[model samples]
Target: MINRRNMLRAGVVAAGVAGGVAVAAGPASAAASGKGWVSVLDHYRDAQGQERDDAGAIQAAINAATAMRPVHSVLVPPGEYVVNREILVSGLNDAVISGHGATLTLTGAAATTPGASAVLKITDSERFEVSGLTVVDNERTQPYNGVSIARSSRGTLNGVSVYGVKWTGLGVFDTTPGASTDIAIINCTAVGTRFGISTNGHDVRIIGNHVAMYWPSTAEAAAKGGVWSAPSDYYDGINVLTGSDRTTVTGNTITECGQAGVYTQDCTNLVVSANTVTGCQLRGIEVDGGSRVAVGVTVSGNTVVDCKGQINLVRARDVSVVGNRLANTSAARAASLIAVNVGSSHVSVVGNHATQAHPTFPAVYVIGDATDVTVAANEVVAGTPYQAPASVALLYRSAAGEFTVGGRLLATKGLGVGNAVAAATPGKVVSKIEVFSASGASLGFVPVYQSIA
Candidate 1:
């Protein structure tokens, strides 16, 4: 049998031929000469090619490598390893665990019940990397996370896949007051978890990943709650929660989540851009201030389809929702395409395209003490007989801004200096503004300032 260590020791080399000409392969010994490479299969396996309960052997190898130097790498080759309990890798600096086609199949007590430990936990570590591995929980009902990193800084989780877990697939959190910073989750895929990826840290980058939550059938979705129930009861694709700052979630595809595809709560300085979100039971993307103030949030260049609501922001400040495309193809039961509500200020909704097949829903709805909002140059087309009283190209209640119709200001409203004005119609020739009172009574159109040139 060609075991992993023997294969590495033999330094297997292969040459390539291009156009019937042979080329020399690089030095075979150079590839296998890393002093820090330790194979887990060599030290802990049964006679029948089955991995033992050797979490301790893997930890021992890591400790041996790290004790000799500050940096090391542990190699896990292609096989299934059964881990009975959580494996801890703590207090290591500049360490890496690289798995090539390796799968860690968790079992036993921790896999049978909900516990505080994760399948693999890395804590109090810095400059770490875990890549090219798959972690799964066969007992899907247990609440074991695939990987948890807490109080760690400057870590990278690359090309990893995690599935069949009960809780979050990857969790990056900080228990202390100061935030964990510079964590990157790149090119990872997670599915069928409660949360695909979640973070409560700062300066995190989540890029080019595919994350999906459980997609229950219509009967199953209704049993959890209604289709439009509160998002707290359902799964989220990617979540950046309280006190997290300067986070970027971009270039990701999220689908089939029960809650918002990309959600932020009490998080500041967030950028959610270029993500494709679809078939969510709730809002596609939501940024809520909650008790803390969320500021400097930008949701741009996203495509959202077939969601109950899309792009919802509440109690946020200095937020920009720009250049997004949203569509509703079914009967709309929730809110509008874009909703800005309650204590939000300095918001800009610009250059978006929204289409609603249902006649009763609004394209954009803005209400409740929101100030300095600019809804400009959006193309919103809805079916006839709009049922929501506030359903229009631009709907505002107790919200004040400089309103424009086809690049012409409404002169009757007496535009104030520094009042932000937006051309509500993009391609159309006619421009109109229908104002409404707080009680949903129509105040009629503000007279156009002048005819278009």
Candidate 2:
């Protein structure tokens, strides 16, 4: 067995001609590039051989790069690097693992403790980056993440692809303090994994990623992928778990999932904007409270299609679902376009255009005792009728709901243009809302109104 002492004690290995690896400029320049980069092949070999794993060689290359100053990048060129265990990069600062056209495939080696296994793990590192890599998880069983960054600061995983894992594909976390935490996971792809992208960190950016290939709910689908912590998480796409703050999930495409596309629980000051979510069996976006209270979440400027439940907020506060376009197909399963359930306060479902497929489910459902709720402006109507007088909303237990946010409603002008909603509870006094008409009358009978101020 080749140990770490033996791997690092030996000098840099030269790229031999028998290796059959691709090198651009020649062996001398690639083996030890004095100009800020070194090839992993300089210390690794026999990746194609099944008898020996390339884990030790790859670890050696990374160790060499990190230990030697100015040689900060370990370039893994176009080849398969078979790894049996986690390639741990701890306290690695100002380094890069450039694997643009390379594959890091995990071998079918059974781990004694699969709970502590990952293909690549960057922990307690600063200003480190791993980009343009394809990580294939062939661990033969469950309980392994593809790439995970924990307790790290300013770490980035850009343009990476993770495939075939029962656990998280790309995960970022802030376990402890002392490190300045800011992470970015941009333009990544996760397919056939349990959780496409799971994060519970502050100051994180999850942008322009594609999450698909695992759909759990339908009978036609094979498997599921989703939230890492909760029991309800079956096949989630982008799950931001508890206590994450100042996070941004924008311009991503989440599709074909059993559960929520973008699910945020107990997160504060978060923004979910300009994303496209489609073909999710559950909600396109869900903002709910967990152990902590969820607040200041903005779900704006999104396009969602063919999702059963579009946007949902449960027991949340200071949340806004604004300027989004949600639509469903004619054969879509029945679900609400927007749902604001009990314990939600200071919530505004404003300036959104929602079109539902099934007439049974309303476009907007304000259920139970939500306080200071506002459903104003824009259009919410049935898609099949096309701007007809449709059952646009249902306000249940709204009249008896209390007012926790102490304030007056916005001065009502005329019922604005494109206000195409009919409250389903005819003759039910809807009084809990804060909005007031220009005639000093409470728009209480959110009951039979065709439009709203």
Q: What TM-score quantifies how close candidate 2 is to the native fold?
A: 0.75
Candidate 1 segments whose C-alpha is farther than 4 A from its true place? 1-34, 45-52, 111-115, 217-234, 384-453
lDDT of 1 by residue, 10-49 (tens): 3322332222233233222324225545456445554566
- Candidate 1: Cα lDDT at 176: 52
Q: What is the lDDT of residue 56 in candidate 1?
A: 60
Candidate 1: global Cα-lDDT?
0.71
Clashing pairs in 1: 360-387
What C-alpha lDDT values do all the predictions have? Answer: 0.71, 0.70
Q: Write the per-residue lDDT of candidate 2 for residues 108-184, one digit (tens) a residue.
A: 64463533567888787777778788888755464678888888877788889998766778988555422335888
Query: Lowest lDDT 10-mer window, candidate 2?
Result: 14-23
Best by lDDT: 1
Off by over 4 Å in 2: 1-30, 45-52, 112-115, 138-140, 174-180, 214-234, 383-453
